[model samples]
Target: MFRLSSLIGCTVLFLISCGTSKKSFVMPSAENISAVKFLGEYDIPYNLLYKNTVVGGLSGIDYDKKNDCYYFICDDRSDNNPARFYKAKIFITPHGIDSAVFTDTRSLLQPDNTVYPNKKQDRLHVPDPEAIRYSPVLNQLIWSSEGERIVKEKDTILANPAVTSIGLDGSFKHSFELPANLTMHATENGPRQNGVLEGMSFANNYKTLFVNVEEPLYEDGPRADITENNAFIRILKFDVASRKNTAQYAYKLEPVAYPANPANAFKINGIPDILNIGTDKFLVIERSFSTGRAACTIRVFITDLHNATDIKNIASLKGNSSFVPATKKLLLNMDDLGIYIDNVEGVTFGPVLPNGHKTLVFVADNNFEKAEKAQLLLFEITE
Candidate 1:
C-alpha cells in the first residue's frame, strides 16, 4: 500500500507497487520507488483575457531550460483562436510554484504562411493538437495532433494524425513520416476516430523520439470498456537521424477506475503525456475520465521497454500472441492525492528543485469552457 499525506490545500498520494517476483516479470521494490510531493497548483482564467485574445485549452506543456520559460500548446483548432502555443514564465522556489504568467503567443501556420482554417471554414478536418514537447536536439518544438475522422455522403474521410516540428517563431520546420499502421482508414481495421497520436517525447540523447496513440489501433484491440481488460496502446520510437521508427512496443491501459454512472459506464482512458526519464524508460501519464461526474482520475507510471517485444511490424496485437508488453510501475495517483483532478493532458520535467530533486509539472486541458479552468499542478519527485 502507498502512503498519503494531507497538506494545506492538497493531498499527496505516494504510490508503490507490491508484488512478488515472477519468472518473466520483475517485482517492484523500494529500491525502485519514486515519490511525488505536491508542491502547488495554479489556474489560468478560462478564456483568459490576454492581448485582446482569449487563451484556454492548454493541452500540452514543455520546459525550455535555455530561457527558463514554459511553452503551453492550446488545442483550440482555430475555433476560439488560431492553432497556437503560448510562452509563459513560471516562478518557482524551494517552497513551491509562485506564479505562472503568459508572456506571448504564436500561431501555427501552414507552409503558405497562413493560419489553419477552422472546421467551420472548411469541411475538411483541421489539426486537433494534443501534445507538444521541446526538442533539445533540434532546438524546436515537436507537437502531435489527433486528426479527426469524417464521413460525408457515405464516403469516409480520414485526416491522418501528424507529428510536426515547428520553429520558435511558429514557422513549420518539418514533419516525420509515420508508419502505415498509424494512418486512419475507412475500414474497421484502422485507427478509430480521434484515437490517433497523442503523447510524445525524445530520449537517447534526443536521437530517438517516442510517440503514442491514445487508444488501441482498430486491428490491435477493441476500445476500452468497463471490463478490467482495457485497450493496449502502441508506443513507437523514431530515430531522428533516420527519420523512421526504430522500435515499438505495446502499453496496456487500465480500465476506468471510477464510473460516473454505473448504468451508463461512460469511462475513458488514454495516454496524454510522456517524458523520457532514463534510457529506454519513461514517465507516462494515463488520464481516465468519467462522464457526468465531471471528475477525472490521473495516474503516473514509470515504464521500461527492457525486454519487451517490439511490435512495430505487427499490424494486430489482438489475436494469439506471445509478445510481452512493457513493464510498468505506478508512481502517483492524483485521485488518492485528494487534488481536484481535471483533464490533465500534459507533463514535463521542470527545473531542478533547490533540494536537488527534479520537479514534475502537469497542465490540464480546459477545452475553453467557461466553467472549466486551465490548471497547472507542480510536484517534486524524489527517488
Candidate 2:
C-alpha cells in the first residue's frame, strides 16, 4: 500500500555566507524561488523475498530515461546476499505516484567477472556502497563506496575508497582515479572510518563528476556535534575523460539539531546525496540522526562554487586560512511537508510532470531492519 500527503507550510529561509569572505548568498523570496512540493510515498516491504533475494536496504537511486526505469542500489555488503541493484518501474502521473514495481535484480560483478563474495568467504574487505548515479557520458552507472577502516593490535588497515562504473548488466567497467589525500591512511590523518565517499553526481554537460564525503577528514576538523561548531567536508570535481580530480572545495555541515538521548547519546550528521542543477550549482542533502529517534532530520539546500576556495593542495582547513566554503540556500525540510522521514540517501531529477514542472525523487535506506521499510518519496519542483 501507499500513502499520500498534501504539501503545507513549506516556507524556510537559509542565510548562506562565508565567515572569511565578503560574499553573501540569499535565496530568492519563497514566492520567486521554485519549491519542491511533496507528492506521494511508497514502501518496499522489509525482507520481501524476490527471486530468492531479500529486497531491502535500497540506499541509492537513479532514473534511466532511455529505459524508463529506476535503478536502486542496495547497501548490502554481501552479508545476506551478493551486492546488487534492482530495476524498478515507477508509474507516475500529475497527481501522484501510482505504483512502484520491482522488475529485475542484478548482482554486481568484479573485474574478474565474478560476483562479490561474502566477507567470511573472502578475507579482503567488502565495499560499503552509499551512492550511485547514471552517467550519460559513459553510458553506465557510477557508484561510490565508503571503504573500511580497521585498527588492529599492531597496524591500522585502511581500505581505499573508490568510485567505480558498471554496466546495466552489472559488468565491471572501470574506476576513477581518486586523489591520494582522499584515501584512507594508517596515520592519524586522512578520511575517518566510515566517513569516506557518499554523495555523487554528474554536471549538466556530463563532462564533470562531483563527489563528497560523509564527514570531515582527520586533518580538516571534527564530525558535527550539538554545538555551534560546524564540521567541514570536501567536494571533489573530476574530469570525466581524464579521470582525474580537477578541483576540490570545502563544504560546511551544520551541527545536529536534535537533542541527544541520555542512555545512548551519540548524534550523526552528514551529506548523503548531491544533484547538479546547473553548471556550478547543486542541490545537496544533509541528513542528521540521533541515537533514540525513529525519525531523522533531512534538509535540502542549493549551493554554488562561485568564489569558493579550492583546497585541492592545502592539507588542512583548520587554523588561519582564507578558504571560503560553498554558500548554501535552504530549499525545504522534509518534516514540514507532512510526510514520514527515514534514512534518505538518494535524490534525482525525475520525469517532467503534467503541469510542466520538474520532478524530484528521494529514496531511503532501511538498513534491512524489520522496524523500517524501504521508501520512495516523490516531489515536484515548482518554479
Candidate 3:
C-alpha cells in the first residue's frame, strides 16, 4: 500500500490493484517535473553505407568502445525472396553525419536462401527490428526483433520477439528466448499492422534491461483525434537471474505546445532511449509524431527515474518544461531528419572522454534505403 500526496489537486492515493494474472500491481504517482536544457551537443557524426536496403530500416543502436567503434542493426533486408539481416558501423558528431559503413554483410537466410529457421511457416519478406544493443562487458551484441511471422496463426502471442547475441564478426553466438510478457507489445491502432515491443537499452551498470513500449495494441481505442492517452512508453527492467522483468515503469509522453505548433497541435512522444546524462541524473528521449506531417521532434527530460517511479497520469506531463530540454532544436520532424533517415531508432551512452566529460550518442535506423543513410550522432556533455 502506497499513499501519495497529490501534487496536482487533492491528495490522491495509490493501492495495489490486481493484475490480469491476479497479481498485485501498484500504479506510479503523478509528478510535476520541470523542463531541462540540452546541455549543448556532444560531437560525434556518422553516415550510412550499404549494398542493399530492401531490408527497409534500422531501429536500435549500441556503442562498443571495447573495439573502439560503434555498432548498429538494420531490420530491413535484401529484396530477394529470402531476406537477410544487415549491420553497419556508425561514427557520429554534433554538427551532422560523417559516415556509416555496412560490415559483416551476411544473410539470415538458409541454403538455397529460402528458409527462416526462427519461424516454421510464412516466408518473411523482411524482419522489422526495433531494438539493438552492444554489451562490451558481455562481448556480445544483443538485439530484439519487433516483427516476426507465424504460419499456424494460432501461435500468435501478442509478441514473440527474439533476443539474439551476435559475435563481433556479426555471427550468431547465443540466442535467448525473450519472455513474451516482458518484451513484446501489441499494436493497437491498426489491427492488421501490429507493432511489437522494440526499444531496448541496458542500464544499472549493464545489470538491468530497459525495454520500452512503442504503442499499445487495440486498447488505444480509435485514432480519431490527436489525444494524450495515445502516447505510451513503458520501461521494463529485467533481472538476469530470475530472467523476468524486475520492475515495470510505464509513463505517458506528455505533450507540450511550443512556438512551432501554436494550436497545441503536437502530441507527446515516448523515450526512444534513456541514459545517465549526468553523475546522478538521467535523460530520456521523449519523442512523438506530428499529425499530417512526416517529421517529429524529441525533447530531453533530466529526471530521476529512480524517483520517477511515482508518475501516475501521463497527460500530467504538461508544464513540466523545467525538467524537459528545449524543443524544435533536436528535430523539425520525426520522419524527416537532417540525414537520410527520419526514423532515428536507438540511443546509448558512450565511455567518458579523457577530459572527464561524458559522451551522449544517438543512432538512426536507415530503414535500409540505398539512398537513405544511417547516422550515429555523438555529443560531449559537460555535467
Clashes of each: 0, 0, 47
Q: Across residues 211-275, which tens digit of lDDT does each residue of candidate 3 receive?
A: 65554333322221244443434455665434455554444555532223444564434455554
Name the better of 2 and 3 by TM-score.
2
Q: What is the lDDT of residue 69 in candidate 3?
A: 62
Q: Every model's Cα RMSD, please?
A: 14.1, 13.9, 14.1
TM-score of each: 0.88, 0.89, 0.60
Which ranges of candidate 3 are over 4 A from the true structure?
Answer: 1-56, 77-98, 106-126, 148-159, 169-194, 217-225, 256-271, 276-282, 308-341, 350-356, 368-373
The number of the candidate with the highest lDDT is: 2
Candidate 1, residue 322: lDDT: 73
Clashing residue pairs, backbone N/CA/C < 3 A, model 2: none
lDDT score, candidate 3, position 79: 34
Q: Mind giving the per-residue lDDT tens digits that candidate 2 earns over 1-383?
A: 33332222222111223334433322111223367888888887779888878998888888876678888888898998998888889998877788888899998888887988766886466878788888655678888888888878885656789888899889999889999888787776899888889898888466788999989998888888878675889999999787799999988998886877873587889998988887578888999988888887899988888779889998888763678999988998887976679989998878877777778889988999988768888888876
Task: For model 1, name the residue pairs that clash.
Answer: none
RMSD of candidate 3 to the truth, in angstroms, is 14.1
In model 2, where do residues sit more than 4 Å from their true spots?
A: 1-33, 154-156
Q: lDDT, candidate 2, residue 95?
A: 74
Query: In angstroms, how far off is 5's CA in candidate 1?
Result: 70
